[model samples]
Target: MDISKYIDYTLLSPTTTERNIIDLCHEAKKNKFYAVCVSSSYVALAKQLLEQTSIKVCSVIGFPLGSTATPSKVYEANQAISDGADEIDMVINLGFLKSKNYVSVLKDISDVKFAIGETPLKVIIEVSELNKNEIIKACEISLDAKVDYIKTSSGFSKGGATLTVVKIIKKTVKDSIKICASGGIDDIETVQKYIDIGVSRVCVSSDFNKKKQSI
Candidate 1:
């Protein structure tokens, strides 16, 4: 299905080094992937490495765990933009969402959105931690916050993106906001499934290149 353009080649490990970011950028350029997703610390280096390419540099804010304060997330988002990130992927506060504090949840996303202005923002809902109802409510809040995309997972959770959860997100958001499916996606076939179900982006690790080669 030629899913390269739909990919956000990601490297978000805590131990990720400069050499790792260098290789990630190299792989993204070689594969013609859509973007390179990295931690904020490496955004500048990735941007500099891919300066001559169209591949966007995406930075994650309050990643994996969305428990960071809203003001902190806003600052991180702004700092990432200033560091040359073309897109921002922020994790949503699962604690607030599950506690029925919809106002805090909504404000958390909205504050970052407002801070980033025109830069694209993708809210990671960490679907594995949420039930069907929570998933729907998360989508509703993301839509209310007017985010550019609602991502499936942070790849650090108990589980990653699932078709069932993606279905719920699709049904809720429809065409209003795009969907980015991340976590445990390692093959073209799986990537094809998400694309078939209307996922606009898929986040995969460097190992994806090995899988693509074997195919």
Candidate 2:
């Protein structure tokens, strides 16, 4: 497989600077990776830097932590889209889900999806914090909300993507939605494994950064 096409060169750290995001976009262009994932604050810069290039600019909303209200997430998504973000990676309210508030979680995703219009939306479910049943429920919610992708983690979580979870997601969604595995993936082998299990995308941060020579 052309592994780079399945990767999103991610840089979501709180300390990530503009220079860093610029470098990340440049690297994505150079490597012909799928896209550059960054914080919402950098969406404008990332868009300008990657303009006219095949590389896409992706921004996050209600990121890392999904405790924010649905309106806030929708507003953030709209702003990012207006700033030229080609796709949105959002976090689901884990607390709401754990509280069995499935309606709120679904509304959170659907509202953002509506606000973005044609732009793709990927919902992050922070797999480490969930059990197998919870993961299944998340997939169900993403499908109901009509999100473009159901992501495994935010990488800030205690763990990252696993093949088993990806497989489960694949089975649960049944091609109704795409799956993105993030968090701890750090190499071509792990990325390939996730792809084999049905992850349409893999979020690569530390591993890609360490290989800056190629960038």
Candidate 3:
């Protein structure tokens, strides 16, 4: 499979500089990765860098850790969309999920989705932090909030995407929402494996960024 179309070339590290984002866009444009996911602060720059191309600018909101207040996340997401982010990948409230506060979790995601309006929203649930039932419940809540995609991790957590978790998300969301398997997605084979099991997008970090140096 042409994994480029299914990959979201990602750079969401704290140490990512402006130059890194610029280079990321270049790689995304050249490789035709599905999109370039960057920190919300650099959405406009990446958007400008990849302008006129089919590549999209995906900005993260309340990223990595989703402990921020809901209003802040809403405002941040709206600002990102206005700043030219074609999509918003906001981290879910893990604390709420961990505490089994399903209602709050759904509300948090729904609020962010409301803020972004028509822009696509991907909720990063960080699967590694949750158990099997928790993961399924998170998926159900995300679907209830009508998220465009359910991402597997933030990559800063314990672990990243695994085939087992991916399958659970696929079966849980089914056709109601899409899945974006991120974190630890290493090579074309791993990317293809996620795609085979119905992942709509895979966020690539090391595999893509390291290869960018080769170019």
Candidate 4:
């Protein structure tokens, strides 16, 4: 299977530089990956570099930490879109979810979705931080918010995407929303495993970009 099309080539490290983004965009173009995922700050630069290419530009909001205020996430999402991001990936508020504040969790996601209009919004639940029940509840809330996708991780946490967690997310969400598995996804075989289980997209770092020749 040509997995390149299902990959969202990512570079979200804090120390990411302009030269790094240029290299990222170049790799995405050459490999024909589905998109290039970067921090909101580099959306415009990635957009400009990938101009005229089919590759989409995705920006992360609230990032590895989802504790940001709702309005702030909304503003960040809009700014990235205005800066030429094709998709938005926002982290869900883990604190609220743990506290069982479903209303606030739902509102946080819903507000961002409303702000972005039709632009695809993927809610990162940061699976590693939550238990089984928490994960399910988070998925349910994301569905209620009508998000486009439920991503597995932020890649900065204690752990990344796991098959068991993905399975739980899949069973909960069913076909209602797409799934994007990120963090520690460094091999093609592992990427194929997620795809086999119905994951729609996978966010891979630059290591996979250099390893694309094996695909």
**Pairs that clash in candidate 4:** none
Query: Which residue runs of candidate 4 sit more than 4 Å off their true CA positions?
Result: none
Error of model 3, residue 34, in angstroms: 1.1
Which candidate number has the best TM-score?
A: 1
Residue range with the least summed lDDT across 10 consecutive positions in model 3: 206-215
| List of clashing residue pairs for candidate 1 | none
In model 1, state the lDDT of residue 63. Answer: 82
Candidate number with the higher lDDT (3 or 4): 4
The C-alpha lDDT values of all candidates are 0.95, 0.88, 0.88, 0.94
Considering summed lDDT, which 10 consecutive residues are worst modelled in model 4? Answer: 206-215
- Candidates, ranked, TM-score: 1, 4, 2, 3
Models 1 onward score TM values of: 0.99, 0.96, 0.95, 0.98
lDDT of 3 by residue, 1-215 (tens): 57788889888889899998888888888788889888888999998898889998898889779999899999998888889999998898899998888889989999988877889999999998999999999989987898899999988998999999999988898899999998888777777788888889988985655764564
Q: Per-residue lDDT for 73-111 in model 2, tens only?
A: 989888888898999999999999999999998988898
Tens-place lDDT per residue, model 1, 35-89, is: 9999999999999999889999999999879999999999999999999999999
Question: What's the ranking of the predictions by lDDT, best on top?
Answer: 1, 4, 2, 3
* Global local distance difference test of model 2: 0.88
RMSD each, Å:
0.6, 1.6, 1.6, 0.8
Deviation in angstroms for 31 in model 3?
0.5
Candidate 2, which segments miss by more than 4 Å at Cα? Answer: 209-215
